[model samples]
Every structure is written in structure tokens, then in C-alpha cells.
Target: MPENPTSQPVPFRGGGFNPRPRALIGLAVMVVLIAVWETGCRTGIIHPLVLPAPSEAATAFMELVDSGLLWTHLGASLSRLVIGWTAGTILGITVGFAIGLFSLARAGMVPLVAAIFPIPKIALLPLFIIWFGIGEGSKVATILFGTFFPTVVATYGGVDNVDRGLIRMGQSFGLSWVSIVRKIILPGALPAILPGFRISAAIAIVLLVAAEMIGAEFGVGAYILMAGSLMAMDQLIAGVAILSTIGLTVSWIIGRAEKALLRWRV
Candidate 1:
């Protein structure tokens, strides 16, 4: 019997990782959660002291905006986040590349990184305050310290994961070491590095908030701390919402970057 061509498998298309349906489902879940939360508050099933209603949180957010306090807090947090994260990421990439490429650096740095990476960065906040002083410096240092280790681990791991066959192929084509690294290794390592950015960015934000809550007076963390002390659940929830917004914005930015930089993959 002859095989029928029409019965051949159609190559699967439009069935993998569709963002629209995923996004819609996520949005639906969020809407349902919010609706349930609001209903619970209205029905007195949830204590306002424990968790403010969404509407109350929204009102508090609006008041902060109208009072110009939002920008003040946002500006301080953004400055610390950018400076600390950038500094840490740059250093991590540099050191990670060195460690990945050179046995000497690996011998010296890998154990040190392993030693430090597992230590709770928040636990060092007091030490940072003592060293850098109770100011922007300390806050930034806390975030920087928290962000650095993960990035280092990520970068070197990325470099290590690059295919040896490709490196040999580059060398066979008479590519210089530097040229091969730039053209092949870096590009190959980028996918790993970009994901590391997301992790480091999140760590930076959390550390930033912790550091701010300690001694800073005009950051989102500080605002939350004050609200908690005063039992202002609405303002505290508003501050939390701001943090969520910041996380979402950062994730979106990283996603855009991945799309732009990793276009060659597709």
C-alpha cells in the first residue's frame, strides 16, 4: 500500500508560548482575586486593620500622588536601585568573565563568591550602615552587595555553558581569540546573563527596601515603615502596590531588552 501525502503530519505551528492567552488568563486571575478581596472587605470578613480594601489603597495612592510625596519617595528609590544595580552588574560581569576565562581568577574568586553568596544580604545591612554611614551610601551598598553575587554566578555559568564546538569552529575559521569571544562566546552567554539581570534586579529592589526601612526618610520602604508604625493599612498597602508596579515595570523592561538582544535566536 502507498502512503498518503495528505495524511502527513502538519508541522506544529502557533501552538507554543502564545503570550496573549497567557496574559489574558493572568489578568483574569488578578481581576478575580481583586474582586474577592473587595467583597471580603465589604462583607466584614476581612479586617481593615489587617489588610486595607483595594479601594482604600487606591485612595491612599491618589493622596500620595496629589501631595507630591509619591515622586519624592519614587525618586529616592529609583536612584538607589539604578546606581546599586548598575554598579553591581558591571562588576559581576567583569569578574565573572575573568573567572570563567582564567583558571587563576577562578581559583581565587569562586570559593569566595560561594562563601559570600549564601549569606543573607539583609543581615549585613547594619554592617553597611556602620561602614557606609546611615545615608544613601549604606542603602545603595546593601542593594549592590545583594545584586553582585547572583550576577557573578549567572555570568560565569553562562560562559561555561557555551558550546565548545562553536569555539573550535570559530578557531578553525581563523578567528582571533578576542574576535571569537566577542562574536561567539558573548552572544552565547547573553541569554543566561539577561535572565540574571531579572534576578539581580529583584534582589536589588528587595535590598533597597530593607535598607530604606532602616534609616532612610524618603523612600517607598520608609513610607511603608512609617505607615505600619502608625497603623495606616491603606498607606502601607499603597506602598506595597507601588513596589509591585516597580517590579512589573522592571520585568517589562527586561523582557523588551531580551526581545531586542535575543532576536537572532528566533
Candidate 2:
């Protein structure tokens, strides 16, 4: 009897081709779009002021780099995001653990957090400006406000859902409360908590741009606004492209860090 083809085992494909082909296809698509855009601009079908070609944007970006202005603005924005997100994450973790562990803290803080979380951060941007001035302080405060609520909610849920049995196992081993939390609770809750950090990183970047638009002297947001006012469409687009790249890079790095640090988790 002839063997059935369906009964034959199919050979497994290697992982090497998985990402490479997809990346190549994406690159090809982008090249085609850029070529079309450049052709349109050169033919005067698309006004340079309205939609600058990729070449024009690239030239503007190179000029900014040569003038050393791009790095300076990027540094300012990066500093604000790092400081604000760090502060927000620390507070979120502390408050989340407190509420998850103690009924008293939950009863006291949950309502307050709920009330504030619904308010738009942009609506309070004016108040932050008034309180912190139009300096780095205001920008940082705005990013922190934008990031804090999401971080708190995600982390609190993670901690609250920690398995009680694991905690008891630690306790039975004569572990102190701190030791039990460090060994059992945090590890158990890490999968949930890590996603919150990723969310906060994205929120921090977005809010940093919004904050910088409000009279900031240096930063990506301010640069985009300045370019727009000057009718420098290429520069404006270049600034936006830079910000997008930064956000992507930060997200990828943090995800890799999470995988490495929480290797023990499910």
C-alpha cells in the first residue's frame, strides 16, 4: 500500500527566515513610497511647503545634525522623560503594594485614585505650568501625571492577584514579611507589572512632547512647533521622525530588559 502524504511528517522551518523576509518586504515598501513622494515633489505635483519629499527631509535633518541642534533638543526631551517616568514608576509601585497588601490603604486611596484618573492630563497642563513654571519642571510634571495613573492601576491589580498559597509557603519557611514579599509576591506579580512599565514608557514620551509644546525653549516638541511656524515642513517632519524612532528604541530596550530580569516568571 502507498503511504499517505498526510501521514508524512512535515519538516519544520528554521527561525532565521521568519523576521528577515518581513523586514526586507517592509524596507522595499518604504523605498517605493519615498521614490513616489520624491518624484511628485520634483514634478511640482506636490508643493514642497505642503509635503516635502523624503530627500528634502533627509537634507534638513542633516543640516540640523551638522549644526549640533538636533542632539541638544533630543537630550532635553530624553532627560524630561527619564526623570518623570522614574518618579512616577517609584510612586506607583509603592502605592500599589500598600493597597494590595492592606485593606486600610485600599479603602483610603482607591477612591482618590479613581477620582483623579478620569481627569484629562491636558486639562491640568495649565495648572502645572502655573505651579512649575515654563521650565523643565513643568514638562517633567506633566509627563509624570500622564504616566502615574496607568502604572498604579496595572501594578495594583498585579499585586492584588498574587497567590496566597505561595505567600504561605514562604511564611511556613520562617521568612520575614519583607522576605516573603520579595521572594513570593513580587516574582508572582512581575508578568503583570512589566506590561505597566511598557505602557508608562510610551505615555511618558507622548506627554513629554505635549509639555514641550507649551513654551519650552528646547525639546523635540518645541522644535516641531518652531519648524511649523517657519513653514519648514521638512524640518517639522524630520523632528517627528526622530521622536518616533526614540519611542520605538525605548520600548524595544525595556521589553528586552523585562524578559531578561523576569526569566523565572510564567
Task: Report per-prediction Cα RMSD to one decimal.
Answer: 4.5, 4.4
Superposition TM-score, candidate 1 onto the true structure: 0.91
State the lDDT of candidate 1 residue by residue for 88-143, as single tens digits: 99999998888888999999999999999999899998999899999998998888
| Residue 139 miss distance in model 2 (angstroms) | 1.0
Give the poorly placed runs of model 1, Cα more than 4 Å off: 1-21
Regions of model 2 farther than 4 Å from truth: 1-36, 39-45
Write model 2 residue lDDT over 158-192, tens digit each, in one string. 98888888888888889999998888888887778
Q: What lDDT does the true structure give each of the candidates?
A: 0.93, 0.87
Clashing pairs in 2: none
250 in model 1: Cα distance from truth in Å?
Answer: 0.6
What is candidate 2's local distance difference test score? 0.87
